[model samples]
Target: MEPRPPSEWEDRVRELARQFSYPPAPDLRSRIPRPGVRRPRGRRWAWAAGAFGAFMLALGILLASPARAGLLEFLQIGAVRIRLQPPPTPSKPAATPSPASGAIPETRMLGILDLAGETTLEAAQAQVPFPIRLPTYPPDLGRPDHVYLQGMGGPAVILVWRDPMRPDRIRLALFEIGPGALIEKITPQVLTATTVHGRPALWVEGPYLLQTRSGRWELRRLVEGHVLLWTEGEVTFRLETDLGMEEAVRIAESLSAP
Candidate 1:
């Protein structure tokens, strides 16, 4: 046995046996599912589906209601704010605007509200945040022949001066705005920019439509020169008169506690 130590032929036979005698690999092919056939089992997918459904439901509800247009057009100067909106559909073709793109419905410019109630000067002053002022330069103008309180935005004070020259004619109207003032869908025939006591003011002259309520916009005529709008303290003032600009400014400057 010592003489027969490993021949070259025996070594080659041993090497061949080692190459063909390895163990079989585990069955990995059956463990993993096919990529296209597998479905997601995570809660993430469920959450994503629910979120998408909720968004669609909210969008549908908004569209079902009366669609309101966003206020893309508006102007704010001093204490007054103006909003321009799409006009209501008229049965007949509407008249072409005088010069501006849109005008306030007439109803608001003259008298924004139908005021049936009257109050004394003391009572009216107590209800509003701002003091009611009367022009003192024109002594004849005296106390407001008519005092009306209306809620347009907040509380509004209306002071009417009857024409001394003409019988039963309105000479001037002064309005004090509480909280603020709003003019909707307004396109003025003439608009002037000026100042009073170094405070910025506006003069809106001519005819325009104004809207406060949804379907109640009406056109108002400005037979007088212009409407003077100015703000003092926390309140805004609107003055309508037949007087000239200087006279209007004088009246505004003459505002004193009545």
Candidate 2:
């Protein structure tokens, strides 16, 4: 019979194993037995076998857990992870009621102003651990109209620029997520693998729910624009705009410390 193909679980395990980084081996030469010292040859082999067994046990436990499995399904890029969930089921409409009954209340969509932790750009910069970067491509594009400091493992800085012609409309928004921070998106319309400055990146076209959890607080917003996600050193950037991919990439590449 032909060789059997690997199962999904097996494939996932192999992928994860490739990404796993093991601790550096300690310097054993200095600890080796001196001229007068005597040690059993089988002792070293037994110790090595024990350590390998323990590591395998831990890996098995994590892979077998449901919670961990869910986390493993996400496509992670730096501080962000995108998970595709099944589309929500549509609800059936109810029959219209008489005048005696009150009309159903309309659900209001959340906008940039509705987000919490609003603050001045200077204040946001001071609060975050990472340096905030600004795009220099659009020479006329000045400073951000609004700045926010929100939590995602740690404090994340958000900068929003509004259209000069239409002050009420946002032109662009940038999220600077530093080390330990994480952003998750659920069921985006499209996700394409891309690259920026030779580093891996993700392009997400959205009308999806984006969420970030920190301690007891959880923030959720509906994203309607395309997002370019990339990382530079320890900082992860998320640029949201209505512009096409080429323009977005140019803007991303023009980021500089301000």
Candidate 3:
């Protein structure tokens, strides 16, 4: 009985000694403090990064909208047209002619509505503000009742028209006035429609300079049934001065194309 008891007791004592001798790794709690500062700092940086990213995304969406994009594009394209000429010079004066000739050879060209028996050379001169004759050539265009006025003057040309039948409808035509064969019908896009001395007209492409032939004096006329625009290389002239439409008609009524 005594030997058995020694064996059991020795085993129990050995187990207890081993457990206490290990001294549990220095209470892990002391090595690491509560709520370490490093973790919170890292979390703060991540939150700030996420907030900044969100703000940039919102701003990008607003600027890319369709209406704002179109406005930006519109600012890039522009449209403009203009014409310039030199100052007019003095030149030889033109002679005053009898209204009956109904033809002005000095005039580089002329146009009129042929009235056959109704309109006469004598009648047209009486209506014009200055001495002028009826056009000798046929109507410039088709077999239509309306007549077309066209002519060239040195570096410039003259264009005008009226209805022979109506005698009231008048048109102050335009063509390229230059050194070469006058380009009939100046590019309309190059001119601006306006009222010059009360008549409807298309001014040469410019801020206010009306004529196209450089350094030439231009003459503009508008009467009850007639309208005229003429120029001599350096000596321009205008006949009917005021009330363009009405004056244009009056002058047009006086025409009788030969």
> What's the lDDT for all of these models?
0.58, 0.64, 0.30
Question: Which is the winner by TM-score between candidate 2 and candidate 3?
Answer: 2
Per-residue lDDT of candidate 3, residues 1-258 (tens digit):
555554433454344333322223446565464574455664775664464334223222222343433332111000111111222332654453221111122212222332111233344334333333343233452222332222242222223445456566543332223333222221122322223232223223211112312322122222322223333222233322224444433443334331
lDDT of 2 at 244: 80
Instruction: Please list the residue runs of candidate 2 whose C-alpha ends up more than 4 Å from where it truly belongs after superposition.
Output: 1-72, 87-109, 207-223
Q: Give the lDDT of residue 85 in candidate 1.
A: 38
Question: For candidate 1, lDDT tens digit of each residue in 47-141?
Answer: 54464334223322322222321323444443455433355556666664321334333343353233334677788888988789888967777
Model 3 spans > 4 angstroms off: 1-166, 171-179, 182-218, 221-258
Candidate number with greatest lDDT: 2
Candidate 2 colliding pairs, count: 0
lDDT of 3 at 127: 36
Q: What is the clash count for each candidate, in the order shown? A: 13, 0, 25
Query: Highest TM-score among the candidates is held by which one?
Result: 2
TM-score of 2: 0.60
Candidate 2 per-residue C-alpha lDDT over 134-188 given as tens digits, one digit per residue, 9 for 90 to 100: 9897888888888878766766787888888977777888888888876666555
lDDT of 2: 0.64
Worst 10 residues of 3 by lDDT: 74-83
Of 1 and 2, the candidate ranking higher by TM-score: 2
